[model samples]
Target: MEFRQVSDLNFNISRVTLGTWAIGGWMWGGSDDQLAVGTVIEALEKGITTIDTAPVYGFGKSEKLVGQALQEFGNRDEIQLATKFGLEWDDEGNVQRNSTRERILKEVDDSLRRLQTDYIDIYQVHWPDLDTDFSETAETLQELLDSGKIRAIGVSNFSPEQMDEFQQTAPIHVCQPPYNLFERGIEKDVIPYCKENGITLLTYGALCRGLLSGKMSKDRTFNKGDMRRDADPKFQGETFDKHLEAVEKLKEYADKNFDKKVIHLAVRWILDKGIDSAIWGARKPEQVTFDNAFGWKFSHKQVKGVEEIVETIVEDPVSPAFMAPPE
Candidate 1:
């Protein structure tokens, strides 16, 4: 339940943000609306105030569910709402990036309607559209800010170069990227650039899409719709086995240093890396319980130890090459 300022924006958010992609059920498996609603309620009760969602997720189904859950809880002002646009989901369930000025304007209106909110606390471009001019997208974001439809605008899955290009035209308050013990790509440039520019680093995949949990076995199989089953490189064949081996080592460190679970150690490790917030994509209440066990305090030695273990196992310098294209 520890809180931190989301950059210098004068607003405080919980260290753990509730990620709504699981609730979207677009690429993940076994998502129940009631279960997702219960998880959201439980997260708010447990002091998690920030909820992250995207319009492309389930082609707006996720935002609708989030709106219903918020209305059911009746605590809109108590929570910090964040969602993204720019990724379009066509009739065939294909995802495409569209950051054109016209598309951005229409998407913001659509998102606000689905979210049941007039203004979003944090509105981000889900990915960079290289085909469109960065300045064009920035201008549209500025218009949204001026119109009060969005309080702040940020970018997600953007490289250091893209961030700089967009920031030159508009103010950015946050940066959301995949950053975890298994994915330290942000350490190269994105994180340092955010620090230098006073942008908050809101990290997702803090569990490496559940790789660091030490639960999935080598023979584990995912449902056909489970996107990571086919999309994640680490989840395929020998890479999956190697990933589990690394998690075993992390478990040893967790056992020796503290009584927390491996997942808690994983989360604490990310927070210790100077990240502004860690987004948790917990579908069940039990998952939340595991994440809540570790809070704001970790010894410097322990932090260093976790880093060393990850580096030793992965043996790859964190790089932006793993980032998916805007689509």
Candidate 2:
């Protein structure tokens, strides 16, 4: 129910954005179209009007489903649509980072058509394409900004140096990065950099691929398409058990201190760190509930306790870099 402004945009987006990566049904096994559409409506009705998706998500299925949901909702002016470009796919479903001017130009129209919107609230580059010039991509996005097709520009998985180069040609109103209890790499630099520059941070993977959802069991199995089955090392060997133990202790900590669950604790921790928003991913409508994460504050001592829980248990923690596609 909380909202935050991106500073550059004219409107405010919900503090919790609905992430449709799973709904796209490309990586996290397949999803039900009916369930996917219902998820969007469920989020909106729950006060989550900011929906974040990408073209490479199901190669466009996510956006199309979002478009269908928007039409069903019947109020385009009230919702903030955040999507991305700079990624292309093949018939076999391989994706490559391609921020070339031509790629973005063509992709923007496709995104508009799929989302059934004339202008995107926040348009971001999915990944940094080292083959392309930062200015080239920046100028192209600036052109879209000038044309009223995109209200704000953002970059994801970008280092501070990459962002420095990107801002030379255009302003970055937002920055999307992988951040959560398990992935704290951004805290070393990205968080501080965005804070100093007045850029809004919309962090993704808040649940760390369902690891922190407090619903995973030791014998749980993943589908062939699930990234956790192979791409993520945290899901393999002792590392998985270490994280699961940490999640268990976190659950206990949440219930003891706040009468909440580990998932709420995970979200409130991110928001308390001053991040503008956290991208909560879910393909099912009932999975979108997060009211417990709000209306409470984490004390410094409580935060230290959660940190101790993670640090003490997950000695061999892994980064989320394994999920990144080949550039």
Candidate 3:
């Protein structure tokens, strides 16, 4: 496993972070606790030291499971517990952006308790709360940093301008943006801003929520609770077929040229794009194979080839905006 250092952080994050949203079982139907625990421990044993989760992910279930896994593994200091806050949920599973000072104040302690850690390595704002002043959120995170409740601050799904406003009060050390083979929206502004500002980029959805995993089939169906069945437009009718076509071509291209799977190519593409890390979502031990994602990269010509394929094939491309919660 490869590691990269983020600004203002004491530890190095794995180049491929373990995303536990699936294990949270919120949007992707349901999850098994034993499987989730096995998955986390397997990833850590395989050298994936950074695990990303959000309180809203399964409404705190993912953090609790990760905590349990870490406890069993018994190596707290070796792992980086990266979790998020600011999105409040209800008993019925409805969520809204709520980054108020009060929300952060309570969420931090709750996350620490669930994660079984006193301090989070990277605590992020899951989304920007349009109603709240950016300073209010930033000030609270600064206090957390000072109090040693969190070692670093991060922001997700934030516009470049919103980050600028938040930075006015506190410096951001890491930024989480949905970035992958299909979701290239952040490459325009967010990626450049992070590079120029010295903030490490830990991009999520390395497989485009299993689209680029190269294991999905047309006849395959998701459960009723699966977010892709409804929340994601790309999984519907013609849009889904178009992406599958691109995936097929990309899969063939990777196997023919690099002798690697599309999953490897997709993740390597992100790392080669200069991203500090890529969040590889997995819910099972077998899905945690990211060691091959490193030690290789797409050639410059191959990168352009990939763009040409996607831009030409997926005429009605979609981003991850549909999954964002209400403001």
Steric overlap count per candidate:
0, 0, 0
Misplaced by over 4 Å in model 1 are 290-296, 316-327
Q: What lDDT does each candidate get?
A: 0.82, 0.92, 0.91
As a TM-score, model 3 comes out at 0.98
Return the lDDT, model 1, position 17. 90
Q: What is the overall TM-score of model 2 with all chains considered together?
A: 0.99
- Point out where model 3 deviates above 4 Å: none
Clashing residue pairs in candidate 2, if any?
none
- Rank order by TM-score, top first? 2, 3, 1
Candidate 3 residue lDDT tens string, 18-60: 9999999998999889999999999999988899999988898
Alpha carbon deviation, residue 172, candidate 1 (Å): 0.5
Q: The CA-based lDDT of model 3 is what?
A: 0.91
Off by over 4 Å in 2: none
Best to worst by lDDT, what's the order?
2, 3, 1
Q: TM-score of each candidate?
A: 0.94, 0.99, 0.98
* Per-residue alpha-carbon lDDT of candidate 1 for residues 1-327, written as tens digits (9 for 90 to 100): 778887667687788898988888887864888888888888888789999999877788888888888888877877889999888766888777889999988988888888888889899999889889999999999988888888788899988889889988998898999888877867889889999989988888877778877687888899888866857778877777777888898899888888767888888878888887899887776677644445446789888888888778777533334436444
Model 2, 75-161: lDDT tens per residue?
899999999999998999988889999999999999999999999989999999999999999999999999999999999999999
